[model samples]
Target: MAKKKKKQKPKQGHPARLQQGVVSMDRVKVGRGLDALTGQFVQWYAEYRDDPELALMVLAAVRETLGVYAEVVGLNKVTDFDPPKLLAVLNSMIEFEETENPEAASNELGTMIYMAWVDYVEFLRDTNQWEREFESLDWFQKTLEAQDPFAGEDEVEADDELDAILDSEEASIAALAEITAMPISTMGRAVLSWVLAGGSSLWTSLPIDQFVETAAKAVENDLPAGLEETRKGLAVALVLQALEAVNAVTLNPQAAPERGVRSQDILEPEDADSFDVNFYFIQACLDMLLEQPGENDQAALEAWGLAALWIVEAADGNPQHAAAPRDEQWSSEVWKTAQVRMHELRVLGLLESGEAYSLPNIVRLAVTDVDDDIFEEDDELDDETLDAIFGPDDVDEPKRLKRETPYTGEVLQLKLTLKDSKPPIWRRVLVPMDLNLGDLHDIIQASFDWYDGHLHSFYENGFGGTTYGPAIAEMDYQKNEAETLVSSVLKKEKDRLDYVYDFGDNWEVRIDVEKILDADGGQLPRCTGGRRMAPMEDSGGIGGWEAKLEILNDPDDPEYEEVAEWCEDFGLDDGEEIDPAYFSKEEINANLDLEF
Candidate 1:
């Protein structure tokens, strides 16, 4: 959760300058100054298509308004401000804010944003875009005497893909109802609010990521009348929806010949190897979230990543992974619903369709089970093919095994130096030969006494191996750090590696394998020696750290006390001066013993 900061006052002389353009008037006088500003805002909104920077300023201004009157504002935090909604709110605020009652501007903007959100939801419903949600409603209302006014509206035809999904979801709900003995009405109501929020379509689509950014804001702000429960339900419903999206292909039984009457030949790996389709699908979702093409959409990626993981766990038959304070049986019932929706995705055809999809890896790895009759090698292989497959009889004979070898404990002595340092803050450590890149991450953090508070990554110098880091970075690189071994990349002494900590600060560390040792029966992965304390957490890299050092050295500096207090928080001092050039080999080894 992001902590809300105190709103700083607007720049000096801002209101004074605005007063010249904003004519003195109340909400009653719309034709005067307010209308003029609305026109200007609308013009800027239109111009945003060409000038993104100008659009960003408008978003910042809206955020400023939200931040200033956060307590009174009813809209959720505007994470990714849609240009049109911002335009609408700007126009509405201009109408409501009187010259004398400037505070009214923030209130009006908040209300308008909330209204825009509601209208957007209504629009989705009106268009029958809420397919998942509509199905939920249809299930419970079947017995009602009051005829649905939207029945004709529902008949509005959907494409084959969408129709397949609607049919699958309906089937899933029915199956779960039977299996769990849970009433359709109860399940329907549980997810009713979710349907209104655009459901699964909203999530996998680009907009859901933007919407999630405002979730904290939604939690803080007051929802419209009778929507409190809807807001609350979103807190849980999103998880279910995200999982369903991640598992859309696997849960579809019709994709496989054995599971359904359709007898579709689902793709599978040709060899004995079986790829974890669920894992790759989740990775693809994470990749999409991390690449967030729109504005500040990092929040969306994180929310979706969490949901994907939960869904994958459920699909693997471990619903306990999402252990919230809910009925375990009900949650299992939901899992069954996802399972039965498998036919919704024709994964084999989709993979072969050559259509651009979010998960290319999933497409690449997807294969179909070979026909047993066609694959019978005895009948299919020609004399030449058999000869190629088995080689000459004498040459094909197996070689005898050599005697057992003794364990040769190998250690890599690495020299890590902070990049761009004057006096040169560095460390030397010896790690085991078989340690993976993921474990090495811990060693580097401990070597520098870093708390591992932020994102980090490793790049092998010269070699084109994938970059390894936090989940988002790994997803972006389409690689897993845990799967990469240290010895695989760094083979001998003088081999170089680059480690970067805290993407924001970009604290780069240059790592060189100083020596490859035979271990000499010594305990492995202990820091052998040298240099300074790590950079302060959240310090803006080398430049910021240097600036802080300057402030600490000068008692007369106005910011000295603040810097000192921050250092104190890190347990650097009681009254003693902070030491940048301090290293503890013993402490490093002790930590390594526990960590390794």
Candidate 2:
């Protein structure tokens, strides 16, 4: 994830919404005596009443430490922000200094104590004490001289207490685990607590040795013992332990060692080849689900139901060649078990009851029992539903020319295909002459049900050519999307352009204008045709989607059940067979209404 640099000056329009929130460290609540550290600092600051320079220096040290901690956790923006917590930390550190040196409390003295505590703790967290560079007090003389104002009191007592805390094996391990598991929301508070505890000499050791020991005990695999004697070995062990905890990857205890244990012990899983596919597919589905408001419960339930049905249907199809590691193919038996599992989930309150899908309107939708002319008034729709249907205040109606006939435009019928897709997945969209490239992007997204969560760009000469999209303040662009008309780039039939969205996923759609309408006026921009469901969002582009298809086709693959379960979770693959070539012009038009 790229962290965008903050702009120096405010932009003209509304501020851009942050893709993610900055984790507030103030939310973390540290354990034990750490809680009282703030109160102590407040009291100490009051004691040093005349020492303004001392106060500034002390405050700066606290702020600097918090900033360093934030950067360590990848929260760069949060470093210099959150004044309330900084103030609290400043109070605590002063209070801590007062208790340590009541007779000779100076700004220079307090800053040294605070800096020493912070650097030492961070050092332990980042590296081991056995490493030569782990001497945290290496900066003791420099920091004091840099901020020289008065002859400072000795910090030997404070250093001694810090050393005592670092020497305690159990205390440090517990603190590290808590730090590592700190939730994003509570990180700030938790970090403050650690600093407070360390200042009080409550925490005395680092968790590296303890974590390594724990991993050795829990994992059945023969962990390399040779690395225990070397700094490099311990570093590798530290990383491996973290990986093993998450199960992102695993290690083999019995693999024959050629060069060393590091070479032979780390083992790749059977699905390692498609790790990106599985990771991206699951993450995309989750991201898609999260983007919707919680009030959309009914729609969410329908999606879940549909996904369940898709899985059941795929399992029953018994297609050849599923994902690897398992060979039990999809069969009637698998379908039966899936049904049982679904029922059990409902009974256990894990899945919603059948009532979720039992509404009359939903039933009608399931059976496609609505009127043939979708635009015609529906006799079955209730007064409230009818009112909702014709709700004028709900949408911003697009302006159209007042013509005796429909507003006519030169229509370009374009085919958009997923690059490198097997069996070729694509969408056909009709673009109006007046529609700008920006709106065209939206129409394409609507055709494929993409959530539009990532950045997109249109290229004049396909993939690597001149691009135009949203403009960033820091960069110059060849073209601006909102002002660039679709017709301006491709006026004639058979002309083409390339559209890519979600740069990370690199989903490239080839837009080829197959036919141009001479006099036709109908709904200007609409889906004319499409093949297959657009690959799940973030399914690692075409390759990941294909891998997922392979898993769905084969029931016997070890990952088949897992893949099927995943589809059900997102309600993507319901038991009902979804035709890969299915296209509904009415449905497409309905979506266009929402978009336009």
lDDT of each: 0.44, 0.44
Prediction-by-prediction clash tally: 9, 29
Query: Which residue pairs in candidate 1 collide?
Result: 76-217, 77-217, 251-342, 252-342, 252-343, 267-367, 267-368, 268-367, 268-368
TM-score of each: 0.38, 0.36
Error of 1 at 202 (Å): 69
lDDT of 1 by residue, 297-320 (tens): 333322322333333322212222
How many clashing pairs in candidate 2? 29
Q: Give the TM-score of candidate 1.
A: 0.38
Name the regions of candidate 1 deviating beyond 4 angstroms. Answer: 1-408, 462-466, 470-475, 571-576
